[model samples]
Target chain A: MDSTNGSQTLEAQAKAFFDSAPPLQNTHQITQKLDHFIQHSSANGEARRIVCVTSGGTTAPLEQRCVRYVDNFSSGHRGATSTEYFLKAGYAVIFLYRRGSFQPFCRSLPDDPLVECFEPIDELNIQVREAYSEAVKRAIVDHHAAVAGGLLLKLPFNTVFEYLQMLQLIATSMRCLGPCAMFYLAAAVSDFYVPWKDMVEHKIQSGSHILDVQLVQVPKMLSILRKDWAPLAFCVSFKLETDSNILLNKAAAALEKYKMHAVVANELTTRKEHVVFVTSGDNIIVQRDKSHSGNDLENPLIELLSERHAAYIKDSNRQV
Target chain B: MDSTNGSQTLEAQAKAFFDSAPPLQNTHQITQKLDHFIQHSSANGEARRIVCVTSGGTTAPLEQRCVRYVDNFSSGHRGATSTEYFLKAGYAVIFLYRRGSFQPFCRSLPDDPLVECFEPIDELNIQVREAYSEAVKRAIVDHHAAVAGGLLLKLPFNTVFEYLQMLQLIATSMRCLGPCAMFYLAAAVSDFYVPWKDMVEHKIQSGSHILDVQLVQVPKMLSILRKDWAPLAFCVSFKLETDSNILLNKAAAALEKYKMHAVVANELTTRKEHVVFVTSGDNIIVQRDKSHSGNDLENPLIELLSERHAAYIKDSNRQV
Candidate 1:
């Protein structure tokens, strides 16, 4: 197909995906929150650099009522950790995360922190346990400062429908920021889905010994985000593969096809230790500082991205 | 097929399922915990009534690496709430739950209670926010007492593999309790699963526009549990359906086929409001007290179950 036809086909597919999706239950509330947060961040004659960090995994429901779903694998550590680093780097962050995934500033806490980390001093009061006191105090203080200062906005999603729809909403809203906006796409979005219209209204019965399910590929939304949603925004996408051999090649292909500013590639097993940045320039490999016990891979990754974002902003200004 | 032949086939299928499955990562640790908990609960010349309450939903992994999986829908509220009620009824609980699902005592707290419900008083300490103080204190005190008093032993699982394996271990461990043991199987387990041997090792590549997955029926373990694992234990299974028309019939059939003492029939829409206890004697519908806003349906349900269990113990002793 010709380039024009290809673009039109993608546009149509994107439109159909959105049109068929069940409308988000809290669109008005979410939009209002985003508007207020963004407006506040941009107030007082300062245009704070704002980035939307997408995290966790999105589900593909086989049934409309959703008794069962296909879920992508993501603990949401990358996005949550990156959000904290971004905030520390002086950027206002909008964290679009999976509903039950990890949250920024709560990384050090236990899984059941409420029950595991607290003890009742009396009938009317509760105190953090001694072991968790430091971690809990830091988490609450840092998280409070971010939210109270209007530097962080957290919105949660569960399914592919909610994730994509919210992404479009966020991208369009961030378009007003011109070159100041960034998209950190880290969520493990579903590759295939049973479209809403094709889904069964009730839970699929288990009477059949052999259950055959047909899932259609989820339409590629990265291209649409780059071309239409927020063309001027700096977008960073991720490629996670269990096989190390095909990682960089797949990431490079994605970067070229989607026009992402950078594609972060890492083998699933080694993702926590290192990542390769596939960009227009040399492929930069960043690793955790083995010498430092407390160092995180995201710490260096965010520093490099922030530098590139600054350089991109300067170049955009020169062009203007 | 003859009953003996059918039973042999089921036993074979169960064996095959377990043989082909990957071993649980923390088998030794889990087994040790269960052994210790059960031994302690039976100590001091007074055997405590013990209930193994299985909660939450188990995942059916589509790939061996598990980048994608099928998940059953359960917020685990029923099991968690039932655990609390069971503890109140003087039953030691072995709560086998999905890893990240709701916990017994932390239900009233916010989803991200660590960051949302607490505030740092200084660099050294943190306190529960006033709005959450009462809830936090009550939850901590109750949960702490139950756990510290050796009445609640919590173990977590993620996959159907882990859940079934853990259930078997718990059942065999509790067999010594005889009529004092109860199995409250409330978890929404997967009806079908991709066998581990048949699953692909890596993340399923999304190169094709269409993905076809064939899932095999998960062998029924309820029958085995009643007949072999813990023959003297009272088992109460659950039936949840979106179609209320077939709920009672299905629950009755399950109770008969699995030889369950009772089967709880719940329609998805009104599960929290009411549930029908499909027992051999009579089916009784129990509802939350509408007059009392603070009342939970599990309160009356557990009370009724406790009374029936007491009667069952008395009958067993008479037979002995």
Candidate 2:
């Protein structure tokens, strides 16, 4: 029974191996890695679409010495939780997430040095409990990753300089992905840090001290997106407002500033509700929703994003 | 005869008591602290200037996943070792350094943290140095320093965000003092860290995997001197370059970029012989001499800095 059955099994294995494509290596590896590049295969729709997603918050130090700091309230939960929906809807996602924070939200995320905060002090001190939790989450995510239709890239940084650098670098890399779609879900960047001058030691007497920081403006790297990246690629950015009355205006200003196609504006309020305003040169509109709790109203979010973005995507059409 | 001698001794005691004054509880404390500040003052033609210095480096963790991280490149050799020259010049220096790495340096210079890095990590890994080197440096910099020139406040952080935040926050506190001078000789402000997006995870992953970092741009916080802190405050920035060729141009750009009145541009190679170009507007040009063996040269460098900068003092009419 063993020999006869084994012969049949061997024949099946041989047939499967030969029928499958050749083993990937050299140029073939590129084809293998990018095979997912065609996921939005809607035949009746006729136009293919892609989406970009950003996740995280922005913050600054509290003390003038900057040994201590504060972060805007963004758990990164909404962004990660929403990504699965974007993927299930058949859109490729360029997930730009903070280094370790995004680890649990999405496993099978690619490896990158930018996400690795090389702080030696934090290296030895990371509690085993956390490491265990991350490991377990990674295992679970990897278990399900084979069927997921998108990619996650982790980028980490202490100060804002590194953050902007990676953004510029990614804008260039996105060119290879074809005319794409973007989702700006990451929290806004921090406002300030020790001024570069004071990053050097400035003297003060031990007592009765008064410290002063002279802040310089950071160049808006986001300006490059509308000016370059998503002209052919669909782009989305975010506007977060903790202050009242400023949310929509600021979001609109941000759209004009980035010249973006759409923006997902959020508030610091307790409600899980969000008012998404899709913007362009001649068009603008707002959509409000309160479907706070569920497997995620992702299907709705995706439908809105894709439908609203259709004209822009079709207009740009395969920029590469 | 005994009564007469006792009377004279009593008179001397009264004089000493009157000069001591009261310990600083508030602004009045500045009067008491001024002597210590004045005594430590770096003397020039006249003791008209006070220089505030922050030495050492700041480090922070990437993700809050209980895995703290840090980044610090200062050896204390530059800030601590070179400070002696400034001290010998008789400038009253307010030196703020880190908890662990700068202890030996602190033993020689002055100033300690009012608060410390007190995170509940495994080993007090000292976010940069697990536990509080706190009031220890505080205890030493000035045991009597309950109050001093410019309100001396101290705080700590696990990430560069905290470090930078502290610097950003407290930096301007000194403006309340309205002091005439300040010096920045510290090193090791990491050019980068965990991206704001990844600020969540406990730890970024490991292994020789390829991870793409979508770097975001951080603002140049140091470029402050050009505006909120100019003229009233003479400012100098730094430049780090890997190659040669129009190196001075690079330094000039920094000066123009940060609006710093001056820039101490040096290459990694300048660590030893200490070659540098000190730029302050188009009017000032002092090329550093690349000659010296260890401590012998420290005195000369101070002289160069003092003499050139002395022109800015109230006593001198020179615009530099």
Candidate 3:
């Protein structure tokens, strides 16, 4: 191969995967998760209630493999679709969705459905941007191949750890919010990530379990919602389990552990039907099981939850 | 209403729409349409190209509601469905979509396409997240309402200006990206916004004119790209015109004016089919007029462009 061929190959490779961010940590990062709730014993709905739905899935950008570092199976059935339902039911929908899922989301909702599309990670000019989305969009558009190819940018590791760091910044900012709010973490965040130590330089031609990825616990996002971020925002956590009783136990435990008003727990392999127990501090409201026309169980669960939330507000208000 | 009710309602409304950022001039906006060749641009073997799609719809957040905002329409059809074709063809996809359509997106791309979602800014704690999705999960597991609701604690806005300012900050940050890209600007960007003369809050009760909307140019995101951001990115700007010939001419002119590589032009009255003209410094590739199948047009386009780009590198090297 000639010099031209060599350069073309490199450019092709770069086209396939480019490292856009500096090879070092770019700047100070923020934690974007909400803090967990405590035993404030503050009467529920004493303050106002705002529901924030994070609708979409995220992938870790990788340079060498030209494949995703992390992935998920999210239908946004609970977040965006149910969001429209909630909005139609007269809730002012402040829709914070993933930009990549915009089209599909728009298709689900009508032209005007009281919605907002929130992107992420403001740019270098983060101060200029009001939404975290604009920051993320600017970064993606600024470094497409690099980011899409899973190359690490700004932060140190290309793994989910750095991504989590970035997420923390946004989540932290959210946790600082006031009272009587709801932060819906419907996004399918990855359970595991590759430790930086288990990395190979030039694409290890052979795959191996020898690459022992020591998975330290990623920061518990929903738990933090109960602890640090919003002492006031209502926190709802989901437990996707196979064992039936464990699901209920976990759901109840989640409410206690997080000091939350509601804990949503469901069996993942129930086939098309969904039965989620909305375990709250005062009562455990298990929504009746409903099978939908579609094969997915999440949609019906969301439908039940949306109504449950409304009832929660109404009940709280009546008591007051 | 009692004092408690009044205060709670006001707080709820305030929490509903948290922060805002002022709108900056569209100084950074520019449309980069391109022109591709015919004979060379074909879907063949060995050249599987990837296209980073930003679609559906998006709203440019503002500190204040005014004529000075830009929001894109996310019809969701052209990009999302077309994406199905791309996925079937075995090409990797970086799906950037808006929020409301999350269910549709989740429904269609349920397995894995590695998508990221973003919604508009009105929602709470979306901008204030502490760490990442994990932390959020943990937060919900720990606390239900307080921490997240506390995060909803934000400085309320008295006017549209404040809202626009908040939006601008988010927009800039979310879109920081790099090259070899493609942005399908099919989202209807809003040109008009409510205006507030002086500091007085003018409430538009029953009688409000459609013309009352004080229209203003939104920040030119395209213009931003045509200039510095993604130098090598292939930006496809949409031109909705009354005349087909005029649309083509205007598109070609736009390609040159903005130094764009390709342009997707359509007659406003036409349904479904888009007469896409691919233009660049060396070649003007016209994709024959046809109904856009809900599949990936990006790969075929990428295959053509990537090969051409590869060829350009080869030829340029020969001359040297």
User: Tens digits of per-residue lDDT for model 2 on B240-301?
Assistant: 55444555777776676556656766555555455464565443333334453234444565
For model 3, the chain A TM-score is: 0.52
Model 2 residue A50 CA deviation in Å: 4.5
Using lDDT, give the best candidate's number.
1
lDDT digits (tens) for residues B1-320 of candidate 3: 12233434534433332322233344233111011111111134333333444445444322132211223333555555544444444433344445433322223332211122222233222222223333223222222222122211111122233323423332232233223233444443333222222212211111111112223332333444555445444456665554455666667766765566566665544524334644755434434334555334443544554555455435544765
Q: Compose the digit string of candidate 2's lDDT tens values, residues A162-244.
A: 44544544555455545544545454464433333334322211111122332323334455455554445567776655454
Q: Which stretch of 10 consecutive residues in model 3 chain A shows the poorest summed lDDT?
A: A32-41
Worst 10 residues of 2 chain B by lDDT: B111-120
Candidate 2: segments with Cα more than 4 A from true spot: A1-50, A58-73, A102-139, A142-150, A176-178, A183-185, A193-198, A201-208, A280-293, A297-299, A318-320, B1-320
Which scores higher on lDDT, 2 or 3?
2
User: How high is the CA lDDT of each candidate model?
Assistant: 0.91, 0.44, 0.39
Model 1 earns a TM-score of 0.97
* Chain A only, candidate 2, TM-score: 0.61
Q: Provide the TM-score of chain B versus the true chain B for each model in turn.
A: 0.96, 0.59, 0.48
lDDT of 3 by residue, A73-181 (tens): 3444556554544433433333344443432223333221211222222221111124434434432332333223222111112233333444444445444334335
TM-scores of the models, in the order given: 0.97, 0.38, 0.34
